[model samples]
Target: MTRRPEQFSLNLRPGNLRSRDPDARAARDFAARDFMDGGGAPALETGRTRLLVAGMVFALAFIVIGWRLVDIAAFSPGGEPRIAATPPAPAFESGRADIVDRNGVVLATSLPTASLYANPRQVRDPAGAAARLVRALPDLSRTEIRAKLSTDRGFIWLKRNLTPREQYRVNRLGIPGLYFEREERRFYPHGRLTAHSIGFTDVDNKGLAGVERSFDAVLRGRAEPLTLSLDLRVQHVLARELAAAMTEFAAIGAAGLVMDAATGEVLAMVSLPDFDPNRPGTAAPEARFNRASLGLYEMGSVFKIFTVAMALDEGVVTLDDGYDASKPIRIARFTINDFHAKNRWLSVPEIFMYSSNIGAARMAMDTGTAVQQAFLGRLGLTRPADIELAEVGRPMVPSPWREINTVTIAYGHGLAVSPVQMASAVVAVVNGGEFRPATLIKHAEGERPAGTRIMSRDTSLKMRRLLRLVVRRGTGRQADAEGYRVGGKTGTADKLIGGRYARDARIASFAAAFPINDPRYVIFVMVDEPKGIARTHGYATGGWVAAPIVRRVVERIGPILGVEPVRDGAHEDGGEELLVRAKARASKVATN
Candidate 1:
């Protein structure tokens, strides 16, 4: 039978090599040689070897891929399998401690938030994704976001601290490569009400200003909430009064402080034009300045408090002593005259009650410069206030210690002190001679820190009488709270701008204490650059602008603090007659 092509094809297998054609004979010869060498056809064996090698490579690759998946799922660094869409849960509480007022009102705390992030490499449409992102976050710039997404980076932060609504809106967009990371953000519930005291934190919860900056490490390390001496109720009353006064007087700014006379605990501290701690970045630098603690000003007649106190304590002058304030004193191109001038010889009490600058200068000269400086240093006025806030102002004192400087400083010029420093010093003068460092920390179980003696108890008692005389009949008459026995002094200083005192730009302030027979609290209010209004009789003096705020604040907070109101003649001291005689003398001098 003739051999068919199919027969030739079937005989082409290994070991079946018999053929008649010359090409087939050559193939058969090669097969026979391969068989003799104990192997298959050379080309076929080579092809099979390559196929086995390729199969092994594919198997090894698949095994490696499976092992990697297993490792990522069970042995990842975060100890959890990371899904592309959902991230791990955040801690319920923030690492930073909470800040609470005296009555346990939350001033500052942290809240959980979802921060938006993205994987740029996985983003299919960078431009489209960024455009959609802007809809959910209008504050974000589309151009900047697009540039961030178009990069080959594996991870990127789109936005941080997204609100619940914002996070939900972003999730609804269903954009690929977008993710959320749980984070804790600092939240100030009271907003601008306690901004200058509580301060604010950065995006990463780092403290930036105020008490937040002063106690940053403590807040981060401790678990218990920080208890501030601030009484939220007192804070509200003080801030409300300051704001109303600022608005009514059209003042550029305002600052006020209320402190416990016995313990030096700060009940309320306010700095106006304040920013909301939650959005501090949006506020102006001027607003962020802590005027209560950071601003230094020549405190005008208020400094007479210290001058008279110094003179009395040093035996340089007594309440019975007298000074010639009839004419302005001209010394070295500087003239010293009283704002509410009584152009006559006045007693020490008359000088304090009338806020006579010329009288104060003469009295301070009698006390001498070295004695005045040492007395102020003892009262903590010549240095930065020792408070819990980081923004404490260093007092600006006259460098040369000249006689002219002493005279000017006596009437609250040639020297500058912060409102906080003034408040603390006043506390020492009125609190039975004990000088305690001002603090924002709440005392434990009603216990207070021991105070250093800065003045004699007799001197403190005498100063209290003089302060009462001013509020009762003199320039600080507006600061008198009925039945509260408010005692205070008024201050109006020309603001020094570019080495010149501007007449219109003035720091009008009132410093007061209540129930002068037995002191309890001290309040200091200062209005910056106050403009005279019609209601104020075209006067932006401390008597017109700041004294009334002290009155209202004391009136409102007296009841809250459980301080019993004194009926007339209920709590009288023997010195009332002395003050009455002093006032009579001042009036007699004024009318002459």
Candidate 2:
């Protein structure tokens, strides 16, 4: 109705009145305003609520990030997130000290080396890697390397003791799984010259032979570097001379030693046909034998020294004592004859100078078995040398001490001792009657160990004079150096094989001491199965073969040992006057 009135009263239709109604118009306007305000507020509130929820989510996320940072910084084992530290490299085992000569020349030393190994777990292309490795190390079999690499095992050794160049080349390949372990390899610098004394070590650096084996514990950190008593210069000279002799005489073998009589220190010891300690595995058993200390033999006339010393020490005979040497002695199917029989009565001096078996047997009979055994024991002939070596041979003494044994032993038969024993015993006789234990180690300062007294100083002096006489005029005359007053004895004994003695096979030997007045050095030379040479008058006796060796050794080493040579006087005519006087005294005794 209001809408109709507002239309200037033009519309009389009901539809027009409905359209023109004021109450209807006002209701419609109110509904439209409510819809606009109320609905819009709900939509805006929903949107604001969604934004608040998003802010909460952001705050929660930041808390979690901060907590994790705190935990990592304060609670972690590796604090403060530092760069990882490289582990320290492991150290190598400390090496043993070197063994040097008296002149400080190197004899034995250790060299650092790399040993090849493999970590099979890290291997890639196992066959190819092995092939390359085999090529680098020809000593290793290719098939073996391939098998080792292909295995499921963790570790394996490819090779050991590679040279520096080899190690470098192997490393250059940079192949996976291949690695190296540090090790020490022992070396003997002088080769075969000092093989017997210096010795050799095993693959694992353990000492196995000669001096190395004897002192293994010391070399393995139990003690310090073992300073030996060897002199390299003297050792070289001795080996060279012995080799020359061996070649010239065409002998089966040879051995020699130069020892200090005053101290029992070995200056040089050489065994012919020796092997280099650096390559000991390639040598044969015979080459490895130490003839000077391990090969015991009947030492021929050199035993006479012990016999005479025993007689004198026991007061069985005097320097003037005499025995009938008119013929060979007969005992138990054995005949003892002098090689150069005088066919007359002889005194003690003549017995030694002429090397008469009959006179020596008579002297032993006077001394008796008890005194002889005791004397030999004192002289260290019945036991191994008290040295730091395992190769020493114990003397072969007759199990039952019979009368025949005594007689044969007196003449250097039916008894066997190493040349080292002979040299040590001889040193005791000439070095003022003291039995100092032989040593390979050097003595400390101001420490001179006292030795057991085996004989009177006077006896030692008399023995020296008699030995001097022998070198001057007796069988040992060949051993005399022109200026050096040398004294020694010659010995030639039949070799024992399979319990029977071979008369043709002989062991010729000589034992000499220089500067006879005050003996300082003792030299021993032995030739095994030496053949008779034309130059030696076809004789293989010690005087012909071993004596010349001693002479050369004395001449060479005399100057080195500071022993001055002197002119030979009438008394220096080795035991000649003593022999004549002994013969005269024997004649007089026989006449009585």
Candidate 3:
């Protein structure tokens, strides 16, 4: 500048200046020497090189960082972490599928619902928020809700499955932390109408009983509705009639079902004292029982169908065969007698028509225990009923099936089976001797599963004639439907109470197959502990109680099922076939 300093620094001085201090003079001499050695330009170049190196180092560092970020985002494997600019968009999910009957009537379905939740930490005043929530949902406990709101949790469920009005009320309060999350709730449109069969779901939409529990996975995996073999109309008729019978007879409970004899498809099933599946928690435990498939009972004379079929199929007895049912067979403190006793020698047809227990027991003994056991197994009566229902009951067969057991079981006493199992076995007896497993799944039009042959076609035909004869002239006469040619047997078994039979507490039931000339449907109805009234002449027997139910159900459902009605003498089996053919077959067997 204006004047160059004599020394640039305290330790440096220009060579032209003379310093007084010795050290200063030495520093000036060294500075002059160094400047001369480097000529000053070299030192300036060194400093500029250092600055360039530093700039390049910083540039390299920034380049490496930028490249790493790009590689991660563009080339990283799916298993590795990748940086995302934003969260993914939500997807549209259709919840659980619907359940419908064969006619497309909705029985169960899922509906989109909003569930109330809250961020407890965001709640400004716990007491105040709970107070407002209680006003909207009175069912929610105020104390419990207040405690939940006071928690430090970031997320909490205040209430689940809120109604639209409830959600509105909560939203109107404008609570800061409260929010609504979308959810789906299972709904049973038919309610108690199909409670035991369609089943119910929990609050989280998980199936809990009946067909729902059995087909839970299929329901969640598919979007299309599930179709059942059940016909809603038939189900309604069966339930209505059963309920009326239950009321009229003052029965403790009732169960009934209608099965396609040829196909083994259950068209309708009903268990009285049923509950509303939509509000299952509010119903009594007894009301939720599935009696048709789960209740095991000694089905009295109904078992005679199987006994006679077994005897006929095994060639142990013929229609022309006779048994002495005049005297009661007293066996080891047990007596086998007929409810409608005819104290005389009776033919097989007469014994069946009269429901003679002594005759059935003698028939079973002639067939032997092992043969009876095998025969029942072939009919699918010695095992659990093969159905789609989750509540199916296993048959209670004697472990060491002895002569006494056989004798008692012949008349439907020692062995206990479910209504569904009995019906399925009866289907085999009347539907051309083929045993088809009962199923709830719908089949294609004109399609039916191949059944296992348990008896000969001839035996099946003979059995059909006998069933018609029973309805025409036996204890099941009341079960006959005009023009339907209903054929069945009546069963009245005393319920076992406290290890003893209670005469008053009886299981009255009837098993029938209609249009016996060409059987279409099989019907079974049971009333538990029915009290006899004046109308029944103080008789709570199967003929007086359950037979009427079968008749009414058949008359109403026959037309619905498209079964043509036949006039008397018009049906194929209207003649004396059982009498004429049995005599001829007996003569032929005797001649052989």
Residues 1-592, candidate 1: write the lDDT tens digits.
1444554575667555544567667655665675667755677879999999999999999999999999887887885546666666864557799999999999999888999999999999999999999988999999999999999999999998899999999999999999999999999999999999999989888999988899999999887899999999999999999999989988999999999999999999999989989999999999999999999999988989999999999988888777778899998888887877878788888788889999999988888989998998998989999998889899998888899999998988888999999999999999998999999999986697899998899999999999988987789999988669888899999999999999899999999998677889999999999999998889999999999999999999999999889877775653568766766776776687
Off by over 4 Å in 1: 1-93, 118-158, 168-178, 568-576, 579-592
lDDT per residue for candidate 2 within 261-294, as digits (tens), equals 8888888898998997998899999999999888
Reference-based lDDT, each prediction: 0.89, 0.83, 0.88
Tens digit per residue, CA lDDT, model 3, 1-592? 2122334555443543655877556666766776868778888789999999999999999999899889877886777546755787875455678999999999998877799999999999999989988988999999999999999999999887887888888889998999899988888888998999999888777888999999998998888899998999999999998999899989999999999998999999899899999899999989999999999999999899989989988999888886778899998888877889978767787777889999999999999999999999988888999999889998899989989999999999989999999999999999999999998888888998999999999998888888888888888889988768888999999999888999899999999998887799999999999999999899999999999999999999999989999866774654266656545654565476
Q: How far is candidate 2 from the true structure (C-alpha RMSD, Å)?
A: 12.9
Scored by lDDT, model 2 comes in at 0.83
With candidate 1 superimposed using the best TM-score fit, by how many Å does residue 251's alpha carbon deviate from the native? Answer: 1.4
Off by over 4 Å in 2: 1-95, 117-159, 168-179, 567-580, 583-592
TM-score of 3: 0.77
With candidate 1 superimposed using the best TM-score fit, by how many Å does residue 392's alpha carbon deviate from the native?
1.7
Pairs with backbone N, CA or C atoms under 3 Å apart (clashes), candidate 2: 2-20, 3-20, 3-21, 4-20, 469-574, 469-575, 470-574, 472-574
Number of the candidate with higher lDDT, 1 or 2: 1
The backbone clash count of each candidate, in order, is 0, 8, 0
- Per-prediction TM-score to the true structure, in the order listed: 0.78, 0.77, 0.77
